[model samples]
Target chain A: MKKLFKFEFRKLLHSKSFYIIFGLGLLSIILFMILGRVMSDFVGDSSEMYNATATMLVVLPNSGIASLLGTYLVLFACSDFSQHTIKNIYARGYSRTSVYFIKYLLSLAATLTVAIFYVLFGFVFTLVLGGHVASIASYMWANLALQFLVLVGMHGMFFGVAMICNKTGVGIIVNVVGIELIFTLLNFLMQIAKIEFNILDYYLEMILANLMNSQQLTTAALVRAIVMPIVYAVGFVTAGWFVNRRREV
Target chain B: MKVMIENFQTNNVVETENLTKVYGQKTVLDHVNMHVAKGDIYGFIGKNGAGKTTLMKLLLGMAQPTEGQMKLFSNGNLNAERHRVGALIEAPAFYGNCSAVENMKRFAILAGADDNEINDILQFVGLGDVGKKHVSKFSLGMKQRLGIALAMLGKPELLILDEPINGLDPEGIKEIRDLLLRLNREQGVTVLVSSHLLDELAKITTRYGIINQGRLVEEVSATELMQRCQQKLHVITDQPAVAAKVIKKLSPKAVITANENSIDVVGITVDSAKVTKELVKNEVAVQDITFAADNMEDYFIQRMGGKA
Candidate 1:
């Protein structure tokens, strides 16, 4: 298990696609920060509100989380199937369960790695840009932690999708299409049943999209942020593992 | 010349009992019982989509058999016993963007081979001086060599290769044939290889298993298949007339025909040793003895029931 895990992690670490996605993510961060800075000059906002550090922590994810996360999931989670490398790994005596976990865990690690690099890069760039670092960015640890769970949870949903698709091009198309319709899938169910409850708030996409905006950190919201994402992570992982175990590849 | 028959012990390296695979409504494999002994270059012959790759998948643990059982290294515990097996099924699959060295290193680690084994394996496959060239830049033959290199890792006792010489030139095919022969001769490794080039397979194979439409029609050794395909024995001697008379005496019921220095003995298997002895007694020196064998492709096609 450890050998397979290390091999899987190294595969992504050495891949060109991983680095390309990381560049796109960094570009999204830099572009959003510059755009926010230019708009602040005309909106008459103070420097403290649109500070670089604050943008780094809060806006980094919200700006490009969907596309960036989708691309990562599409490439890493299922590209091996199209390359047929997973068949080689299986022929080498690794079990189906072990391969599944290695891929899933490495996907999680890659998401965290890119997210941390963006945050740190934004922090350093604020200093170089001669912008005052806001104290609120330092105290935004709770929101940051919540957003991390939201990201992981969102990854779990796409991880399942990628596993079932098992083709990179199809995975990309399905992931992009799934993200577009996922928010309203449950709402459609609720409206057809004539139910008044808005179940969309509990979905991974909804929670992640609204994570930094609703910074109340209420007890119910805290439980929802913590419990909902973990459930999706566990639920989707279990489902995907079974799907992989029965597959011929 | 053929392999020494004594080395072929009954210790089966690979055995399948009534194995079957069904995909949807189509039955891909139907009750195949394959036997590969310890020192055999077992050539599995079949046309496209004839369950050659499916059987390989089951042996590699890449797919579950729908019915029946398979044993590797004579052990029923396939997962544990599979560690002793290596394979190159269909095309070589690798991270195309990575260098050949990097790709080999990655699979070597996963296969539990020592890092020191890398250079030796790459050199064995004639890819020693690639110098960090990416696999995506490699030609089809180079990629096939890399795939073979990957299979040679971890000291596998049994190698299962499917269509290994598909894209190679004639020289490359001969090189691979020599490699397999060397491995079987020097290391006593058992090889299960499939190829469309029946002539190449006939040169190296010690045994054959012909499959047609998901059924294993036959499993026979090279010597036995040759005997079944023999047309007549041709003998060369100093005096063809005397040799023909001697061969006629050895097999009276056979038809003997002679040319300037050679005699053809048809319709029977004669004692060539006795004929050689009698020819020497008659002062007609025996030079060479051989049999006109049938084309291996025709024989295999017949074994496959004229399917391909």
Candidate 2:
């Protein structure tokens, strides 16, 4: 199992697409930043959104991280199936369960690594755009940690979709765009009806939004933050593992 | 059961009893009892969709057996014993975007082989010089060689290769044939190979297992299959050199080769009595003559035709 993990991790690291995904994300950000700079030339940088913390808030979700990360996770997980390389692994005597979980652990590590990089870049861009850092706060650190968890939780969803669908073409569509569209529609409908009691509070997407946008963390928000992502991480991974194990090579 | 397991541990590298696999509404493999003995290049012959890949998949644990038992180099511990096996079933499975060495490195790690073994394996399969080339750009033959390189890792005790030489040129085929022969001869590797090319299979296989419609119809040694499939007449004589001269004079186009004690005449139209008479008329002194099927492809076609 350790060897399997090392080999998979090595493959992931060696993948040019892995770094390309990150580069593309950064390129899009650069282009968007230039547009924002041009727009600010007339408006004169009066807004408070250019600060380090506020820039992170505006860019992390909107920076194409969600979609990019979603697509990358699906691509990574389904490459074994899409390329049929899993046959080699299984033929080498590694159990299906071991392969599934090793891939899961690798995906988890990837999510956390991307999340850290995104946050760091968001801060770096604030300085690039000539904004000052905000005063450090304990609650802010907690919020950042919770948001990273939310990213991982979402990564789990993408991983699950990839494993269950077992093909890059279909899995990427479903996870990166399809599932998010469904959640967005659900949120839209809830608003049109003006329903007070929200069922989506326990969902990762909703929790991620609430954590990213909330000014102060409430007890209910804290509980949802802790419980929802864990559920997504564990629940999705378990489902993916089961589906992958029973799946034919 | 214990006795059978012990017997196979020494005598056979693979033994399966009543091994069956069924899809949603169709049975792909129906109760096959296969045995691949040690040091055997076992040829698994079958037409496409005739369950050759299905049986290979079942042996490698890529698919579950609906009803059966298989022992691989040991008793019941399939996972442990599977460590001694290397298989490449169906189309070459690989990361196309990665270089051959990178892909080899990836699988070699999983296969418990040292990174140093990668160069030697690639060289053996003729991919050593082009190790840095991405597999996507590779021709079908190159990819096939890469697949073989992957299967040859870890010095496995047994190899299960299905149609491994699909897209190779004649020279490539000969190279792979020599490679398989050398591996078997030098390291005592037991190989179970399935190929649509019966003639090519005939060249390297030590024994044969013929499959028709998910059933192993026959298991015979190479010599036995040749004797069974061959229709050429072997004319034993006191002077084989003289017999060859007379046969060449009798028919210029006839493939007549002289053995130490006999002249093998390969042709369907050659009558034994006519050859015997010709050899005797030339004072060649014919002692005996016999005829049988002379082509593996012809025999296989007959077999498959009979099954059909």
Model 1 residue B30 distance off true place after TM-score fit, in angstroms: 1.8
**DockQ comparisons of all candidates to the true complex:** 0.53, 0.59
| lDDT per residue as tens, model 1, B62-155 | 8899999998877888878766777899998888988888988888878788767988888888999998888999999999999888888887
Candidate 2 lDDT by residue in tens digits, B1-308: 99987776678888888988899888888889888899999999877777889998888879889999988874556777777888888899999988999888888887788877988898889998995778999999999999999998888989999998999999999998899999999999999999988888889999988887888877889988765555677888889988888777777776777888987876536577888888778887777888765467867766654531
Shift of residue B306 alpha carbon in model 2, Å: 3.3
Candidate 1 Cα lDDT to native: 0.81
**Which run of 10 residues does model 2 chain B get worst, by summed lDDT?**
B299-308
- Candidate 2 — which residues are off by over 4 angstroms? A27-59, A128-134, A187-203, A216-218, B1-5, B230-295, B305-308
List model 1 lDDT by residue over A1-249, tens digit each: 887887887788787878887788788777866666667777978474346566555655545766767777878888778789887888877889888888888888878877887887877766665677766744377777788888788788778778877788887877777656765887898899999987876866666666556555567666788899888788877888888887987
